[model samples]
Target: MIVPSSNLTMETELPRMLRAREEAEPGDRFVFHSARARMQHVTPEQLLAMNQQATRAAAELADGRPDVVATACLVAIMAQGPGYHCTAEDDITGALRAEGCSAPVVSSAGALLSGIAALSARKVAILTPYMKPLTKAVADYIEDAGIEVVDAVSLEVPDNLAVARLDPADLREHHRKLDLARADALVLSACVQMPSLPAIQPVEDEVGIPVLSAATATAFRILTELGLPPRVPGVGRLLSGVEEPAA
Candidate 1:
């Protein structure tokens, strides 16, 4: 995981969401390594600056020769506009190649897009911790990928650390407040930094639709890219066996 320096949620939540089942083999567990990029705000300038560290971070992690690398900041890539995750993934792959290593790379932005597609969700609702402008960027970014953002609510938070400090229970209430009648899926955390891993399944049960967070989507994409079964229970509908979208 390559995350923003001020974003404290991914490392904690991802491991919990992806833990090996109790009956698995001794070595069946997945190991995670992370690299941090400097970021304290959700603005365009800060996002661009934070993204500059991706290549170097990829190179550093490639030294371990892991199965996959994930750039786990969603808004950073989305704020770059549509299709930027491809560019970001390419950059990471290039860096790994330069280090004489190869591993599939996934970005939170790309994973979210792919997860939504795998669910075949068209009209979707989103919950974001960004301010209005940044939230709009995320909604537009998703729209460019052929999905419709039927409704979106922003928390209008500026401090990245504060966004991390948000409670998952509060997220459940916010999700309940969304107009979910027509929404095919609910993006519990459009931004990776915001904490929503624990809220995913409960909210889905409450709303009777798929609910997913960027962290879980990235985990599902990583497992898919590695040719592993995506049977992660308790995350959401996406991981319980939603076939990977057609490439």
Candidate 2:
């Protein structure tokens, strides 16, 4: 697991989900590696410039030959353009391969869109800890996936670490205030740095709709790519598909 230096949540949230799974099967173990990212009011240029350095740092961490690498920042890659995750994933994979390390690469932005599509979500409500500009980028990325972002809100937090420290309970409250009548699903939290995993299912139940977070969707994507079952009870129907769990 490799993440942006400014990202303070993925390092903790991802492992929380993995560990919850490991508790069911103690044999599984998880670890992480982080690389620097210019996340403080990150500009498009700054994000692209950081990718090469981030990839290099990830290669150093792959000295142990991990099975896969995940690019944890969603907007950083999405801000580049539509379908940019394909190129970003390729670049990261190529970097790792050049270092004699072969691993599938997953981007949170790509994974979030994939997760939404997998569930056949057509209309969604979104919440983000980003400023209006970055949040629009995320909404556009989702719209590029053919999903309608019917409603959206941003907490307006600019500091990366501060975004990570946002209370999940507060997020749920903010979610409660959103209009969900036309939304088929609620993107309870869009940014990985926003604390959301702990609040998704409850919010879903209360809103009577499927709720998803960046971390939860990323987990779903990683497990799917790993040829493993994605179901982990308590997250939402996305993990446990309408027909069957993601085995």
True-structure RMSD, every candidate: 1.4, 2.4
lDDT of 2 by residue, 62-121 (tens): 687877788888878778878888888887888788888877888898888877877778
Residue lDDT tens for model 1, 122-180 = 98999998999998999999999999998999999999999989998899788866788
Tell me model 1's lDDT, rounded to 2 decimals. Answer: 0.87
- List the candidate 1 regions with Cα displacement exceeding 4 Å: 20-27
Worst 10 residues of 2 by lDDT: 238-247
Stretches of candidate 2 exceeding 4 Å from the true structure: 241-247
- Judge candidate 1 at residue 48 and give its lDDT: 99
What is the TM-score (0 to 1) of candidate 2? 0.91
Question: In model 2, what lDDT does residue 233 have?
Answer: 69
**Clash totals in order:** 0, 0
